[model samples]
Target: MTQLPPRFEISRQDIARVVAVFYERIRGHPGLGPVFAAHVDDWPSHEAKVTDFWANAILHERSYDGNPVEVHRRAGNVRPGMFDTWLALFDHVLAREVTPQQAQAWSALAHRIGRTVRAGVVDQAKGPGGVPILR
Candidate 1:
């Protein structure tokens, strides 16, 4: 019989820590930094918002109230394919910050949210001909 890994409760502090580290990486990333800088005017506030989002998501805390899809759609410089880079960086950060199971769970949630946001951005970018420009 195969043994399963022990389940550990993830806390808000853990989420905050991960968010802090992840954004630090993002701030230094050549591909993602410029894109983020164009949209985010305040790094501290943005980090807090992201930490709240993840804490609410992972812990079911109901702390985040903003619509992420709308936010992403409003980011004109955010390309559809940027989610891939974002997720890759997120996964890399998670691997160093959390257990494998935790990382997998968080990564899955991130991917799902990323797809939803990307779809919204794509849909909003449709031309009058109803064709997406694939940006």
Candidate 2:
């Protein structure tokens, strides 16, 4: 009988690795670094949040519950084009470290998060003076 690969799993350690590499790239990204740097004071806390978020999103671990869209909106005017750049960076890191299926899942997750965040921001912006509720 032929052996097959085991079911894919998103471990906390694996998610940490991905988040680390992703942030490494994000830190160097010209478009996002300044914005991230200006706002995020605690790198470890931020990394932990991302790790939990991805683990929950991809692995159904339920390790994260905070509002992601609120987090993004707090960054202020995350121009539409930034999502593409963010996705590109995420894909690059994920591809370098994870399986194809894992990468695909992450890509889809990122798009969903981006859309959710964007929609929340846009909806909040529609209020009286075109400003988001959180920031």
Candidate 3:
């Protein structure tokens, strides 16, 4: 029997490989490295979880069960400005790890998610009841 194609025209193994390389670079990145190292103790475990996350997102596997919004919001270190840096690095990883079409599709998805997570982080910093802080 022929296997069903993965979502967004990307393969599951490619996602896992990209995630691994992305995090490997993250661990050594000047800004992102310290941020992640502060929270992540086990690199292998984190990579696996993130791999599952990508699988769920791009493969529709439903294996990931974590809330990125809450996690980034509660981290206190996650900043809206940081998403730009994160997306840039991630885009670079995608370009190197996968085909151009796959990179384009997945990078678009990553940017969308980054915007969402960034909004969540910013919203959590509101003065009260989701209201923006004023001077």
User: What is the C-alpha local distance difference test score of each model?
Assistant: 0.84, 0.77, 0.85
Model 1 scores a C-alpha lDDT of: 0.84
Give candidate 1's error at residue 106 in angstroms.
Answer: 0.6
User: Order of all candidates by TM-score, from best down to worst?
Assistant: 3, 1, 2
Which pairs clash in model 2? none
Q: In what order do the candidates fall by lDDT, top score first?
A: 3, 1, 2
Candidate 3 has what TM-score? Answer: 0.88
Query: Candidates' TM-scores?
Result: 0.87, 0.80, 0.88
**Candidate 2 residues 36-99, lDDT tens each?**
8988799889999988887777666667989977876676756555777888888888888989
Superposed model 1: Cα runs more than 4 Å off: 1-8
Model 2 deviation from native, Cα RMSD in Å: 5.8
Instruction: Determine which window of 10 residues in candidate 3 has minimal summed lDDT.
Output: 126-135
Query: Which stretches of candidate 3 lie above 4 Å from their native place?
Result: 1-5, 127-135
lDDT value, residue 72 of candidate 2: 68
Question: Candidate 1 residues 1-135, lDDT tens each?
Answer: 554332336887888899889989999999999999888888889988998887777766666889998888888888777888999999999999998989988888898988899888888887778988565
